[model samples]
Target: MSDERSLATDRRGAAAHPQLCAGRRARLAEAMARLGGGVAVLPTAPERQRNSDNDHPFRHCSHFHYLTGFDEPQAWLLLEADGRSTLLCREKNLEREIWDGHRVGPAAAPAALGVHEAHPVDALDKIATDKLANAPAVWFPFGVHEGLQARIDGWLATLRERERLGVQPPQAQRDLTPVLAEMRLLKDEHELGTMRRAARISAQAHARAMRFSAAHFRSTQGRGLPEYMIEAELLHEFRRHGAQSPAYGSIVAAGANACVLHYAAGDAELRPGELCLIDAGCELDGYASDITRTFPADGSFSAAQRELYDVVLAAQEAAIAATRPGARKQDAHWAAVRVLAQGMLDSGLLNRDKVGDVESVIDSGAYRAFYMHGTGHWLGRDVHDVGEYLSLDEAPVEQPDGMGGRVVKRPSRVLQPGMVVTIEPGLYVRPAEGVPERFWHIGIRIEDDAVITDNGCELISRDVPVAPREIEALMRG
Candidate 1:
């Protein structure tokens, strides 16, 4: 949390750097005014080195940068609703810059970030305490940092027993979710453009993986290839295509491994003839793009493979078609689930696939056995970008029906313009060892990033292979 311990060098030549900073400042200003002038503490997440000698690269907090736009660690962004933003950063040191790289310490932070004030990070605690003191309300993410909360408490306690009679804390200490989430709903042009580039790079990575599947594809039959290898290939491609890094962990699940939604370790290999589901995305300039594709390891699906893959792909396509303004985020999921449940019902896998049963599963999400995980996630900034998915009326949007009940349990955030999210509806059938002959090791998932528009949505990764023949062609080409 200190520049003394920071691994970052100074900023290099990049026009995007300043623009990124200014854009976030705009969002912060809007939020600060809404909450009544108060100080908001935005902390930068520090870098965790890969090892003692090899430090990991620092990735700025999307939300924090969305406001302050400072790229240094141990930095704190102070936004005073009075209409001023200041960045507190590490002071520059010749020794460190020569050792690591150039730094945007206190001196350079103002010009670099377009802030009204700049100070050394060392002054953060004192400055924050002074600014937060006596304010009617203090705005800080309590659970996000216990120390900050305790500081607020101490500041309040000091005020209550005030040697200074006029200073006092405000009555309400609310979570800062309302304005922050609301501001992130509509993507500014800059955000949308960055996300578009990320989607484009993500598409290239998927295509590269498809074309070079053999060099790294898994093929052990019952067992699969190491999930990590597929992740490596994608990472290689992402960097080659100018992606700063993966937006999140690359989920490289092979066969039954895919059954575990959000699989962590990428150790499993693609079993020969089995499916390898790659749920991965990369960040281009802090904008995120998520894409998933499941394909056979042998570059061809069996009759059953095609059956299940086609079902998921079909459901995804249908869902994609239904995304539009006025449509809810849940709408697409509802449509995809019904279609997938019907596919399972027709295949005799679910044993029930009628209007009533499908509707029930759509309502209860019983088909999760094969089609687990949400249809998609918000895509931008953080991989699961910010924004409300539900409408003000609280009606569910494109969310698939037949999911578990509980409104909060479901992300009813309405779909709106300038939102980018992935539309990935999948089906995974993992038969217990020697349990059922009807089901066996199989997991198929197809995912794509879609940009929500005013009337409809645009498929950004249309270049990625989704159709069976196209995948085959890409692999064979």
Candidate 2:
């Protein structure tokens, strides 16, 4: 694997980069102000033991991290609509720190994290109850964390009990997710920069995997290459580029394995003539980038492979073109569907006489036999990032019946500036009656991370080759 560390230099230094939690907390507090001023408690993910003695790798909750960049477990953030913030976290214990790891602890959290006050985790109940008393509303993620609802219930009960002492309890309860989700949907400048670096690193990783597959195939004398080897190449490139980890499970599907969307079982052997579809990406500084590329294991695509690859590529291109401000998110998927449906018809994969035109095929969903999934999804802190696809208004979707058909409702979230999404269009062809035998067992998906702009969209992962000739040349070179 190459020692290229393109992303290493781009990473912001830890000391130079404060968590910026102060600004984020202020913004969230402003949003919470509309709720008539209350207390909000957000907790980070709890550490779980992987086994009897060992603990699993700890990751902060996305919502929690969005509010506070604090990464430690056993931590809760208390936000007040009046612009005060408190961090309830673990207290320092030298004995525990020696065996486990260092913690900022309650003592330095206020100064280090830019909060107004800090307390030990044990004081959360008392503090939350006191804060909730006489407040108009209490807000938290309603059903996300297990037992969290019960905890809030207990707090409310405590407040109710104190009502006889002239203390008023919170009158309303609200879920804070919608406000936070909307805030997170539009990427800020810092987030975009981080996501762009993530895309580049992930794109380079894909190229590295392709090169590794090519070399491994040649070295093995056309026998085969294990899927895990290609996956390893992706991992090597990711970590070498300073990524903490892959954004999600690396899908290194070889041959028929590619047909299974979300396939991560990397036990299959990639044959020389087979197409390897690798859907992988990495996370950098809490942002994520997802990219998928399919290429021939032996450095070049076969005739059938090239044909299917072109169709998916064209579909992805149409999806990318449709990704612009003011356009609905579904517009990209429909664009990709139209292109893929036409291509399938032209290639004799779908009979025109039965499936009719692209519109009819789409209405009947006959194309789903080969192309089953959506064109893309929102990509951000999480691979399937949070954001509302639908507005409060309901729009009528005319069904094929022309009279009474199901309303065509999908995530109608309009494309907006700073919104990033994946434009991935794929065809997973399995052997079936009326399906072409040559196209059987062929799964081709072309994916690229796209950021919606005022004029159109920008392809962040454009560094990776998408064209057949370009991929072949890169492998041969």
Candidate 3:
């Protein structure tokens, strides 16, 4: 994609880019002070495998960056409220630097990250044990850090052995995720700015896909294009417009393939009379924006295609209108479901024997045949984002066998200020053995990136057309 210079702000120094990095230090210190005493371990993300002799781009973990803005890998940021944050990183490695990139070496980390002390990464065990001597707790998120977990376990084993001599260890291990997640949920000024740029970059790519696809259709207008070609055009546009990379794989599903919710293979060929559904996003400075649109393959929608498209579009609008701070996210999902089911009933797709009432039919799982996926998901660092739906004291969700587990097909918890999420409601009718021929294959989805605010939520991706007339005009252009 294009370089991030346009969207990039003045990040030359910590003083200049103080909001996400510098400001986070203050908040984290505040949290540490409140907890009495603890040693917080924040590890940088690991290098991801691509293939032999190659690796994917390295991205710093958000939590690590939050406390200490150091982006270097293999670093451990240890925070002690009273003392300084100790940054542990690999020292200068001449051989690896030649293969990879420049190194910020251990010596410079203290000054760069505003830390009081710094050391080589190999010293993690000794330092952690020494700091935790008088601490009642050791804080870190538990699930994703295997190596760190093992290190802590090993250290704890040694301390427990020392207990024979009347030595005490850290009284408890605390989960720091709640504190971090709460802080992230409320986007500061810098985060909102980054999100706006991310949405703009992705919007340009979406518009490019529309303009280019229409042009391709107009010329041999019916020459036909493969689903994968459309997919490539979108990928190119995103990068060309300044996205670091796609937030997720684009779903360029054509005809029946659109019925598959997360379809990413993108191998179908577009027919003259069919629909192409694209669900894609772009990442800017680690922030993400998600957008999905469905349009005619031949530049004009068929009657059935338009019908299903309108139903999905209406559902999206309903969901968008219901979004506001403090409103439970389930409100929008249920509202969209009500509108969608009513449209289906009017289309003769639902009956008394099949679905009882149009208003309540969706929650009964009657809509799965046509709408398999949830209406939306939280969007940020990761596609699903890093946060919990339930409060800190609430019990984790549980399910019996044969039922979709905790993370599957559940409504989002609530809409809160500074939270960014995707609002996408869709409908699909694939031809089936017992179904009528008229409803052969139709799929449509309209997604928007939204930011929740105090007064109301902001629609970050309104640039793309969603209305019937507007979409037609966009295609004509």
Identify the superior model by TM-score, candidate 2 or candidate 3: 2
The most accurate candidate by lDDT is: 2
Clashes of 2: 1
Better structure of 1 and 2 per TM-score: 2
Clashing pairs in 3: 1-239, 2-239, 217-221
Model 1 TM-score? Answer: 0.86
* Least accurate 10 contiguous residues by lDDT in model 2: 397-406
- Score candidate 2 by lDDT: 0.86
What order do candidates take by lDDT, descending? 2, 3, 1
Give per-residue CA lDDT, model 3, range 1-477, as digits (tens): 333566444423222353446567667767877876677877889988899978888877877765666677788888776655788899999999998888878887666666778889998888877777667788888897768778788888777787877767788888878888777766766777777777876776777777767888788757767877887777886776566788888888877787788898456688777788888888766677888888887668888777778888888888988888878666677678778888777776666466677634654656666776666777776667777654444444542111222242343466788888788988888776544566677778889988888887899887777787777788788
Question: Which residues of candidate 1, in runs, are more than 4 Å off?
Answer: 1-20, 23-27, 47-56, 157-165, 215-225, 265-267, 353-357, 392-411, 432-439
Ranked by TM-score from best down, the candidates are 2, 3, 1
lDDT of 2 by residue, 1-477 (tens): 232555688576222244565777788888889657788888988898999999988878888877767788999988989989888989999999998799999888877777889999999999999888888888898889998989999999998998889998889998988888888899877888889999999999999988888888778798778888888888998898899899999999999999999899467899988999999999987788999999999998989999989999899888888899989888898899889989999988999998799878877887888888888898899999998877546665543331214466543778899999999999999888998899999999988999888899989997889999999998987
Q: What TM-score would candidate 3 get against the native?
A: 0.88
Where does the lowest 10-residue lDDT sum fall in candidate 1?
A: 4-13
Query: Pairing residues by index, what is the TM-score of model 2?
Result: 0.95
lDDT of 1 by residue, 329-438 (tens): 87898789879988878776776623347767667767776777778778777888766655555434344344566543445656778878889888777775422454
